[model samples]
Target: MWTAVLLACVGCYLLKLAGMSVPARVLDHPLVERVADLIPVALLAALVAVQVFAAGPGLTVDARAAGLAFAFVALLLRAPFLVVVIGAAAVAAGLRLL
Candidate 1:
C-alpha cells in the first residue's frame, strides 16, 4: 500500500513538472487559450450531470433532476444567483418531502 502511494505521488509530481515545462509560446496559442477557457465549464457541467443523474450502478431522475431543471429555468429568466440557488434547493427539498 505504501509503495503504491509513493509511486502515485512521484507520478503526480512528474506530471506537474511536465505541465510546468510546456513552452510559453505553445501555451499562448489561440486554440490552447480557447480550450483552457472552456475546460472548467465542461468539467463543471460533467460534475453536475454525474451528481444529479447517477445512482450507484444505474441512473436516476428524481428530486435532484427537478432542482437542476428549476435552476435552468431560473437562469434562463435571469434570476439572481442567490435566488436561483435557493430556488433550486427549495424545489428539490419540496419534491423530496412529497
Candidate 2:
C-alpha cells in the first residue's frame, strides 16, 4: 500500500510537470481559443436543460421546468444570480409542494 501511494504521487507530479512545462506556442492557436469559446456555451446549454427537464433517464417537465425557464430569461436580462436561483427554487418548491 505504501509503495502504491508513493508511485501514485510521483506519477501525478510528473503529469503536472508535463502540463506546466508545455510551450506557450501550443496553446496560442486560434483553434484552441475557438473551441474554448464554444465549450462554455455548450456546457451552459447542457446544464440548463438538465436542471430544467431532468428527473431521471428520460426527460421530464414539471414545476422545476417552469421555474428554470423563467430564471433563464431573467438571467438573460441581467438579473442577479442569488435572485434567480432563489426565485426559481421558490417557484419550483411552491409548485411542487403547494
Candidate 3:
C-alpha cells in the first residue's frame, strides 16, 4: 500500500511536470484554448450526473433527481446561485421527509 501511494505521488508529480513543460505556442492554440475553457464545465456536469444518479453500484432516481430538476428550472428562470442551491436542498429535504 505504501509503495502504491508513493508511485501515485511520483506519477502525479511527473504529470504536472509534463504540463509545465508544454510549449507556449501549443498551449496558445485555439483548439487547446477552447478545450481548456470547457474542461471545468464538462467535469462539473459529469460530477453532478454521477452524484444525482449513482447509488452504490447501481443508478437511482429519487429526491435527488427532483432537486436537480428544480435546480435546472430555477437556472432557466435566471435564479441566483444561492437561491438555486437553497431551493434544491429544500426540495430534496422536503421530498425525503415524506
Best by lDDT: 3
* Evaluation by lDDT, superior candidate among 1 and 3: 3
lDDT (C-alpha, whole model) for all candidates: 0.99, 0.88, 1.00
Highest TM-score model number: 3
- The TM-score between candidate 2 and the true structure equals 0.66
Residue range 35-98, candidate 3, lDDT tens digits: 9999999999999999999999999999999999999999999999999999999999999999
**By TM-score, highest first, what's the ranking?**
3, 1, 2
Kindly indicate the candidate among 2 and 3 with the higher lDDT.
Answer: 3
Off by over 4 Å in 2: 1-23
What would the per-residue lDDT of candidate 1 be over residues 1-98, giving only the tens digit for each residue? 99999999999999999999999999999999999999999999999999999999899899999999999999999999999999999999999999
Could you tell me the lDDT of residue 12 within candidate 3?
100
Say what the RMSD of model 1 is: 0.9
Cα-based RMSD of the predictions, in order? Answer: 0.9, 3.9, 0.5
Put the candidates in lDDT order, highest first: 3, 1, 2
Which pairs clash in model 3?
Answer: none
- The clash count of every prediction, one per candidate, is 0, 0, 0
